[model samples]
Target chain A: MDAAIRFHGVGKSFKKKRVLDNISFSIPKGEVYGILGENGAGKSTMLKMMANLCLPDQGGIEVLGQKPSWELYQKIAYLSDRAKWYSDYTVEEALQYGKNFYPDFQMDRAEELVEFFKLDRRLLGKEMSKGQEARLQFLLCFSRDVELMLLDEPFSGIDLITREKMIELIIESIMERKLTLVITTHEIDEVEGLLNRVSFVKDTKIVVEGEVEELRLKSGSLKELYREVYA
Target chain B: METRVVGSYRFILDFSQPIYEQLVQQFRQMLAKGEIELGSKLPSVRDFAVQMKINPSTVVRAYQELERDGLCEKRRGQGTFITSSADQVAGLRREMAENALESFVEVLKILGVTQEEAQKMIAGVEWK
Candidate 1:
């Protein structure tokens, strides 16, 4: 299987504080892969590097078979934990913005996702609740026909019902588009079943990575391995 | 379905499947049997994890699976509770069991266990 994302000797640091250390891994195409870690374990930092939002201090990174750069930006959608929107823009405007940046953006699919997520197209981005904003961001991300998606904490601030809907939407998109997703989240339980594989991050490094069932059989549970690694 | 309070435990899980699916199926079955009692507190995610000696995430996955099937609801700051539509649990159980049985029988056959021997082995189990 072709790799959607690959990191080689990837290292990052901020103001002398190391975040990611000698990280190396590959996420195969058409798989829902997870980056599991506790808060401040550099989960989001690694995702940022993969999304090309930030450059690694050392080593190489690839997204969609190419070096992380502006050229491949449209082929990948990165949703950070802190999703921002123009206060004056409506849901339709956000979709349009996405279309402008991403050549593969699907307008009809955006509309369908908005409807499915129950977001009002007329509601201004600023007027939306936290949950609604998360849902709207999710809708926009899903609407983009990207080859790889990097979502950093997509479930934060969302209600359980909305989270479930978002997960189902993701599953459907993964099946239909054969998209590869690398998600970082604290809500491991919510995404456990959906993940085909998991990469456990600890001490600013990837300690374990493999098929979910294989790890589950060995560690007896994802949570167990997480505790053993991070605790 | 009737729930019997055996010993100090409020309920029992009678499925002869893998522990993970058994945990999920039994929880749903408890709700269907009214043993969970709507509004009654189910086990905590951590408590269940310790009891099963598995990861809390696995317990959480099981609960999330149950929630997705609409057999349970999780309230923020409160524990999960049985849903009113517990009858749906029966359909889910049948579907899951059928899938598991298919794989189980296939594996048994692959391991050189004849259908008759499998049946005999299954019948030899002493049920209380």
Candidate 2:
């Protein structure tokens, strides 16, 4: 029952707009946690704090049994819409770059993954279609053996088929590495099955959170509850 | 590797009943029907979750239930496999059949028909 992440009243505000307010939840190791909400639900902001990309205005947050810091960032593979480190890198080059950037990055596995996904080696990260790019991004992220993997809106722009591919690959990687994943998305239907647990963020805080089955049994499906809360 | 389907089948969500219960019941039926052969490898929790489009944790619970029932066993680092013991499979099959028969008898009682009448009705069913 080791905790991969723990947030104690974590709060953040951006330019007078409070994005998060006392958000508290703990994610256990080797679990697929879904951070779910609608648009402007502070999901991204909370993820930024975990990635050490943003400083929380108040409260404490712990990732991988330690405070958020640059060293901790090294152990976290964050997938976000943040600036691409090397969008111009070809599929092959991305692996080379990822290897140099993350010591745990597995170039051999990355090559295998790209081939498995049938992603062309010649296509640059910036040149691939949105779906192709998403698949590449997921492959590159999973190449690193990190304690925690954070995904922000993983299927936002991808097509249905590509999203399915991404989900399959993600599961394969999680099972192989026993990685802890925290994925944020507004699309409830897409992630209902992949998540081990779920936290429904509303009005700048977590209004509901629990293991998916328990919550579904106690209340109802996440989609129905999410609709009721957001409606 | 990447696109591998460790579990093959779509799981349609049933909101009225607990998902893990549904999953366990489905796997049990598959076991009784020999849809999944004895000693076969069951899919990993995450892979089954993706296939069913349900939470991975729920799949874990279902696998745990299967283990509790002596239906499946998880090998360290190898994965979960169906029970190898013949007695265990036979017991499960008998349990499933009895449960089905119980429900059938209950429906017959509600229909105001006896087992004798049910037998005649079964015999009367066209075999074409």
Top-DockQ structure, candidate number: 2
- Candidate 1 achieves a global lDDT of 0.76
lDDT of 2: 0.83
Query: Candidate 2 has which clashing residue pairs, if any?
Result: A193-B53, A193-B54, A193-B55
Residues A69-165 of candidate 1 have per-residue lDDT tens digits of 8778767888975758546899888888888977888998998888898888888989988788888888888888778899998987688888767
Which candidate ranks first by TM-score, i.e. highest? 2
Model 1: CAPRI class:
incorrect
Q: Where in model 1 is the C-alpha error above 4 Å?
A: B1-128
lDDT of 2 by residue, A26-104 (tens): 9999999999998899998888888999988899988888999999999898998665765778988888888988999
What is every candidate's C-alpha DockQ against the true complex, given to 2 decimals? Answer: 0.04, 0.40
Q: Tell me the tens digit of each residue's lDDT in model 2 across B30-106.
A: 77777777898887776576676555667778899999999999999999999988788789999888998899989
Residue pairs that clash (backbone atoms under 3 angstroms), model 1: none
TM-score on alpha carbons, each prediction: 0.67, 0.83
lDDT of each structure? 0.76, 0.83
lDDT string for model 1 (B31-75, tens) is 555456555566776455433333354567777888887877899
